[model samples]
Target: MEKLLVVEDDIGIQKQLKWTLDDYDVVFAGDKSSAISSLRRFTPKVVTLDLGLPPDAENASEGLATLQEILSLDPSCKVIVITGNEDNLNALEAIKLGAHDFYQKPINDEELTVIINRAFFVSSIETENAKREALECEDTPIIGTSPKIMRVKSMIDKVAPTELTTLLLGESGTGKDLIAREIHQKSRRNTKPFVAINCASIPENLLESELFGYEKGAFTGAQKTTPGKIECANGGTLFLDEIGDMPYPLQAKILRFLQDKVVERVGGRTQIPVDIKIVCATNQNLREMVLEKTFREDLFYRISEIVIDIPPLRERNEDVLILSRMLLNQCADMLSKKFTGFSDEAMAALMAHSWPGNIRELQNKIRSAAVMSDTKLISVMDLGLDDTHDELDFSLKVTREKAEKEAVSKALAYCDGNVSNTAKYLGITRPTLYHAS
Candidate 1:
């Protein structure tokens, strides 16, 4: 049985509450001072606080002070405020001051029971999540030592504690999703759900309903009522990946939801309020798209209150080698292989190659090499880089730059110096190709 501190000045009401909540190790308090004492002694996860206590029995001053004290002691505590029938204003004020929920003075045993049970269930979930976070700290998936990565780590530390909407800008496979999860895990909302949706992956027709949910029989296939990702992530995070690819029409609805913190299900008239931290990721150049009128500029600004630009592996300097080794070790353990490390030639090849696909590409290459390696050390041949390494310059910078330059030069010749055609053939932006040239 979990401890529950009930703070009520009325003896009759206190007795009724204790009897009703007999399942819990219920402790009673008559005033603000006694409530604080009971809170320190029992450290209850849930507290049913009355709005009128002792010397100020006719007013809500004492109860409000107690609520503040309880929250200051343990922010996670779910304090349910008990108020008189005419004290609706006071109850609302208590909610603003961090009371989890409020009950009217003439309490129905069944109704109060349901609310307390919900608080207990929510408290249990939060406790489990806190433990899981601690375990995650013991072994993290993020592996890097580069200055760029270090800066990202520092930024995560600073930004995660706040409730700002964050935008992760990076090339595909550069671990944007991983960083989003890291932010969620480090936030106060970690104990709640972390719902992720790739705006680019779902069809435009279904994306709206997927986000805002739908009423029963809202559509032909709507079998039952469903709460969408936004509602499901009510107290946690909603990660919108590839937000640039989100359909232009749906962007307005999303913007509306973000602005109001409320959403109405498809075919539903009721607006359901939700509380969540929004984190969005995109690979596209949003500012350029805004200028081209392909994306909503206002929505872009709304989601990008805090932008974190994650450089590609090519720009990450030596993080490639560091990530490669870590991935190799992870693969070895999973596959039950005896791989110690990579060979000198393998390391050279890894350093030389331009990882255009970034972390995802590197992971795939390492997994393949780990499985193919015959000796304890993984070699360049095992990684399928033997033939390519010979063509690489390995002089000024990575061989990928050399490859890019050669491809661009040939494309330019083939296109007869036409920038557009050259860029098209090389599958790069004109600005990118011009910079390369």
Candidate 2:
């Protein structure tokens, strides 16, 4: 169990905090001496230090001393100082003394809980990242020595620093969205929000409202005013996934909005100006769509100022093995399962197979293997792939799975009153069921 050390001078408040942090194994202390002793005993990852302790219950002198000592002992510990409503001075002092944060007294239990929970969540992420680094010498989203993936990574390193409108083209599951996120995280707007919307997912009627927001009286369901992802991500990055699916009419409006950094909400006459970078991704062939008059050439030019084409997984030579190992670890973490890795046969099969569905198919197969593998190591059979099957077998297998049951029932009914077997006549299942109730 995780430990929480609560140091408060008042016995009543100490008991209250002890019960408040009941989810954790909480330790309580009354004064500086008791607080130090508890800290030494618990070595807690999280500690709540009240600003007023004994001998200094009306002041922060002794409380500051306790904070310093806890830091000197365990610098990694998250020390959250409990402060008075108007005690900003001591809070600042505590912050300068390395306190993670200060919570005002007479706190809303929910707000305090959110703060504590977020602190712990961040702490856990950092701890996991550290462990990952220790196990592997490096960390990067794009992994491989393949020329295609390598070029994409090199482009990200260069383009990520700029505020350019980038359009990523690839097949589905080719990591287009991941590349967009990499651009956001590595860009000058790294600290800002990275908003993503799927153009294909939202209906054309609602896509306008989703991109430009709506006023209270915009539509029948518009109960209140709301900002869309584009406006919400102002001063950040807005990623439009499946840009090819964007309707033809809406494309004109989006083009105007991109040309001028302003948008008019649905059902409202006012124009709101916003500043944001755009990153668009699609699994469709935009050039072909342009030739077919489905996609707008003007809008295409606007988004594809800097285009990056990502290759499908089948073309990336050694990336299959690298991606598999990385995917294996991620699957293990999410499922909370201990999967050492895939079998040698599985790795070879994955490497040789043509990933027509690309990275997304690989991801699904890994997830299936992780959940269904009979042992710690997964095999090619677990992937449910038929690499060696001919076209005839493939067609036969699909037909049997889909239509066999229906055909069998029809045959049995037509052969009514026959006391012997049916599949012995049909030859579908092993040890066929005998006929006649």
Candidate 3:
């Protein structure tokens, strides 16, 4: 049962209320101080304040102050003020001071009960709505139901629990960094820091000092000792983004650190030991770079202990609409706008366009459309996409071949690369399925 606080000075009225409000777990107080004490102790969601408390029974000053304090303590609390007959002015003042509602005395049990029930209902609705909003905001790190993305999630689940050096290989704007962070979040070191640094963004001259700490007076600007990214990420996960762009000279030191969990600071003699998990990401082909002598083969082998390949958004065709809707809703909430959905033309444009920039490009388009759209649904023109150029080819033979290929591919993924199971699922012979694939 929900708790209710009743503030009334008269003993006779209190007894009558206890009988009338037998449905609730009610607590009674006769003065402002007692009422506040009960409110703090019980933390009741609903309260009844008599606008004529002990010291100031003839006036509404004490009750009004109690009402303000109650509202201040819990802004979501429902405060129903009780006033004497012909006290409309004081009742209005109580309402202005943030009371939920007011009931004039001689108290009518039936009418007041209705008001109390309604306030409880409203409070419950608001509480549920707040919960739903929180859930929607923190849904998941990776969002998609496509087979390829599902495979990626499965890989992450398998690798996150161990202390494996993970390597994320993907195209530019394909969310390699997001995958890296997800791995760290699911790892044992989640409680510690998850430090990230972009190798390509930092210049060669400062990269060494940034990765390894410098002792005080080691260099002209190195007046005080400072820890590098690897040292700062001790007992945590260190994310090296764009590792393919790392300077060739520094590759030997990184390899040594990986082989032996220790780092020697620049111009320092001591080698500090560290316990950390390294997660590296790169858009370039490290194997090709190694063959060309641009990357160290031993370092590449050390980092790629566990490899996860992130597919481009265009490749995950089924996820385009899902990602677009989610991104649009997020943008709308941030911009404080009401957007229902996308127009038919806008959705077609989204699916048909080749997203060279992948998820990043899709997010930009949706955000732009949400800002420019005046109506509930965003149109193709608002997205600034040329639907004419993105029109699908409607040839019967070509469409049939494309559908058959997609069905086979999805079946293969769903069956975990089992040829017989995929053939059975597609209702085709094994040899036929093999030829189609």
For all candidates in order, the CA lDDT equals: 0.88, 0.83, 0.89
> TM-score for all predictions?
0.58, 0.57, 0.62
TM-score of 2: 0.57
Which digits, one per residue and each the tens of the lDDT, describe model 1 over residues 308-404?
Answer: 9898898875667767877898898999988889888888888888888888989999999988888889998999875456443434235546666
- Badly placed stretches (over 4 Å) of model 1 are 1-140, 386-437
Taking the tens digit of each residue's C-alpha lDDT, what string does model 2 give over 1-437?
36778888788776666657655667888888888898888788888899888897899998999999999998888888999999999999999999998999886767776777666666667765664564366446766666788798889889888877899999988988889999988888878888999999999999999999999978898999998888999988999999999999999999999999899999888999998889999989899999999999999999998999999998895678778888999989998888878776677678777888998899899998888887888888887766563322324235544465666677778768352445556643434344211
lDDT per residue as tens, model 3, 1-437: 46889999999999988988866668999998999899999998889999999799999999999999989989999999999999999999998989999999888889998988788778877875664465357535787767798799889988989998999999998998888889989889999999999999999999999999888888899989999999999999999999999999999999999999999999999989999999999999999999999999999999999999999998998688878988998998899999889988788888898899999999999998988898999999999999796666645346657777999999999999999999999877898788778
Candidate order by TM-score, decreasing, is 3, 1, 2
Highest lDDT among the candidates is held by which one? 3
How many residue pairs clash (N, CA or C atoms closer than 3 angstroms) in each of the candidate models, in the order given? Answer: 0, 0, 0
| Residue 302 miss distance in model 2 (angstroms) | 1.0
Clashes of 1: 0
Error of 2 at 419 (Å): 79
* lDDT at 255, model 1: 95
RMSD of each: 26.5, 27.4, 18.0
Model with the higher TM-score, candidate 1 or 2: 1
